[model samples]
Target chain A: MTIPVSITVNGRRYDREVEPRLLLVHFIRDVLGLTGTKVGCDTSQCGSCTILLDGVSAKACTCLAVQADGASVTTIEGLAGDSELHPLQESFWNKHGLQCGYCTPGMILASHELLRCNADPSAEEIRHGLEGNMCRCTGYQNIVRAVRDAAETMQGGTS
Target chain B: MFAPQFDYYRASSVAEAAALLEQHPDSKVLAGGHSLIPVLKLRLAAPSALIDIGRIDGIRGIREEAGRIVIGALTTHAEIAASATLQSGATALSEAAGMIGDPAVRNRGTIGGNVAHADPASDLPAVLRCLGAEFSIAGSSGTRTVDAADFFEGLMTTAVEEHEILTSISLPSGSGGQGSAYAKFSHPASRYAVIGAAASVAVADGVCSAASVALGGLVPAPVRAEAVEDALVGKALSAGAIADAARCVGDSLDDDEVLGDVYASAEYRSAVAHVWVGRALTAAAARCG
Candidate 1:
């Protein structure tokens, strides 16, 4: 069966006929060609499929595309403007938060959601915030640093 | 993983959802999709239709009415974790919500879906049982309330009827020095509880007037330690007395059958159960003080 779903993604409204079984992650990646949102684990264990739904970070893999109809979603690719990088992205690059970079986009998006609500999250708070995201390559130390750095930058710190 | 094909209906209201469920007998309600999607991907259970109730209005708030806190069915774990009301009134529920499958899961997973799925390893069921929460279910007929103790039947099962949708969970206002705590040993990979305990104690004049203990992850469903509660009543709120009461969990386990998995042995889970009960009791006692 096909269902008409109209969703707003990254300030763009898209209307599409989707299958009931279509996952929100696949819809964002395959239908919209926003491949930045990676699907690491089909299971909800890995946070590689994290995305912002209605301004909150959530696992996109477990959410049905139809469930997101009439809702606002933001993927990793939608974080920055055309020329500028999001603060979290810049922090990841400057802090060497990524080793393989497979988990970078999701990590940045998750961190973006955290910093939106909490501009100055402590190290423990950042760790707790990013607990859902798994980064096998960087060992999480740099990820934590990148989030803290991004929080500082977002708070208008010169450095 | 691709989910199996099924007819999808986005229900705008509780009545619409109930009607859809009634129309399609083999349909499932999609809330957070944390539990159902996995089953669909695994092909373990396939429903003919999915009634997505994620966008339903009036099912997403937390409010206090009279002397009870009413939590809407679609209230996400993230909301609960950040809720000051829950933190102050139902600290155990807030702690358990915080310990759910991390941030992303907490942000998406709804409390309604968790309790409806009735997973043995879920931290909320035990805490709800300990707190004596009540569930409000809506159907074509009308709304009905079910006590937490009577709601859960067995493994991954509940008393929720096929046509019924769980709308909200209600917890009575704490009065007269009531304290509660939930403690769990989680699986490293999935973060599901291997053995969890939720304890609530009503203290008066430095003595325990009433106590309730619910154990999870060790059995098919969350079970109350009635013997322990009975033993702890009127006992002095001391570490030694709490320890003695916690030992009654072993007695409770002897009467009930406990499920064992690769993560823990029956004996090991029983031991962990005692430790968790002790920890919960200690925390609850501290809250009383």
Candidate 2:
């Protein structure tokens, strides 16, 4: 059976009929064609499918498309504004937070949540907050640095 | 790694959820989808339908009411962790909730689903048992309340039947001279507990008046460390006294009941239980008065 779902992504609402068993991550990637959100681990353990569901960070791989009906989703594609990069993206780029870059989108989005809740987080707090997302490359030192830099930049401090 | 084909029904209210449960005998109530989704993906459980109650309105939040902390069913682990009332009153629960499966998992995993699924390694079951929490279950007929002692039956088992929906959980709010803590030896990769201990200590005039200690993760169900509790009830909660009491944790655990996996052997987990229990009691004692 298929269910009708209307999810607003990046402030644009898209209505579709998805198979009841189809995952929200698949719908965002396949149906919506927003491939910035990668599926890593497919299980909820890896946060590569992390997205903002109703302004809160959640694992999209764990959520079914039907479950996301009427919800507002913000994927990595939604991070930038017009031509400028989101402060998190800019910080990641400037800090060389990615070597393989597979975990960057989810890392950035999860960091965005941490910064949204906490305007200025310490290095340890950033590492702890981004524990959900995993990066096989960079050994997480630069990821921590990137999130720290993003927090500073987002908080009106020069980074 | 995808959930098998199953019909999805979004329930509007608790009453409707209960009705759906009655109608779809093979259906599972989907809350935050933390526990259930993983189970579904692993093909461990394939229900005919998934009644998505994640969006139910009135069944999510923590409320301080009449010396009790009442937590609605759909309250996420992150919500419980961030609950200022729970933080101040029910320290063990909030602390344990905060430590479950990192940040993103906590954001979406609900306490009700955690308890209902009753994963042996889950954190809340032990903490709830330590706090003497009560569970409210709604059925087609009416709602019934079950104490924490009676709620968890065994591994992956709970008192919630097929026709019932867990609605809320309640426990006494923290008071002066009383405190709680949860200590766990977590597996590195998955972060699931190897041995989780939750302790609640009540002290009066520099002496321990009461104590409730429970352990999970390595056992099939939350086992009460009654001997540990008895030893502490009349002691001064001294380091030596706490250590002595922590040793009694072995009395409550049977050799046959301990769980062994690739990460830790049964003997290893049994050996670690006393350590984590002692740590939990020490932390709880420090927080007490």
Candidate 3:
């Protein structure tokens, strides 16, 4: 059976009918064509499918599309404005946070959620916050640095 | 991997969710979906209906009431890890929550879902058991409470009936200089506990008045080391005494009961269990002192 789902993504509303078995990741990637949200491990082990669900980062792969009906979601593509990049996006690029860029979107989204609630997270706090997201390349040092750099910029500090 | 076809219902309230579950025998409650979705994707579980309770109100908060900490079933691990109340009153729980399946799983997974799933490898069950938490369940009949010890029946099994939905968990207020800690050796791949220990100690005048030790990922269900707890009472809160009591965890396990998988061996898990128990005991005792 198909269930009607109305979700707001990146400030735009999408109304559609979806299968109960369709994963939120699939819905975002295939239905909405927001392919920035990559699916790494279909299991919840990997953070590549991370997205902001109602302001909190969640694994899109584990969530059913029908579960997200009437909810608000934010993908990595939503992080940038028409002409400028989000501070975290800029920091990731400047700090060499991405090597393959496969995990970048998820990492960025997760970091966005972390920095939203915690503007000034300590190193340990940042590490703990990003534990759910995984990056095989760059050894995570640069990613941590990117988040720290972004946090500084968000606090109105010069980069 | 495509999940099997099923009817979906987004319940507006807990009562509606319970009614849906009661109406469909093959229906399953979808919380964080960290546990249920994987099984569905793997075709291990084929529920005919999925009642999504993620949208239900009043099932997602961490509150303190009447000297007890009440965590709603929908309270995510991130919420628990970030909760000041949990950090102050139930530090072990917060620590365990921080350690569950890395950051993404923690962000998406819920405490009630973890406890309801009743996986022996889950860190929350052992820690909550050590804290003497009570689980609240709601059904078509009514609501009922079950102690943590009684809530976990076996591997991947809980006291929750098929028609019942776990609503929340309540942890007792620590009193009389009580302190607690949780220690676990996680499998690097899955982050599930290879062997985990949660310890709570109540000290009075530099002596241990009472202690509870719970073990997980070493058996089919979380095990309370009653023998070790008995050995610690009246003993001076010292490192040596803690070590002795921790070592008694091995005696509580049967030769066939120790967990073994690709990540670890039975003997290794038993050894790690002893080490983790000692660490948890020492840390908890330090807090007590």
Query: lDDT: which candidate is best?
Result: 2
Tens-digit lDDT track for model 2 on B226-287? 98999889889889999999999888999999999988999999887888999999999999
What fraction of correct interface contacts does each candidate retain?
0.98, 0.88, 0.92
Candidate 1: tens digits of C-alpha lDDT, residues B1-289: 8867899887999999999999999999999998889889999888999888988878887999999999999999989988988887888998999999988888888999999999898999999999989999999999999999889998989989988999999998666598888999999998999988998898988789989899998888888999889889998888899888898888787534787777788878987687899899999888874
> What lDDT tens digits, residue by residue, belong to model 2 across residues A1-159?
888889999999999989988889999999999999999999877789999999989899988888888899999999899999998999899998999988988988899889988989999898889888888875998888988898888778887
DockQ ranking, high to low: 1, 2, 3
Candidate 3: deviation at residue B227, Å?
A: 1.7
* Candidate 2 clashing pairs, residues 3+ apart or interchain: none
Task: Looking at model 3 chain B, report the run of 10 residues with the lowest lDDT sum.
Answer: B99-108
Clashes of 1: 0
Which CAPRI level is candidate 3?
medium
Q: What is the lDDT of residue B207 in candidate 3?
A: 87
DockQ of each: 0.87, 0.85, 0.77
| Overall local distance difference test of candidate 2 | 0.91
| lDDT of each residue in B172-261, candidate 3, tens digit only | 867648888999888887889888899999998878999999999888888899888988999997889988888898778887877798
Candidates 2 and 3, the one with greater TM-score: 2
Model 1 ranges off by over 4 Å: B254-256
Using lDDT as the measure, name the better of candidate 1 and candidate 2: 2
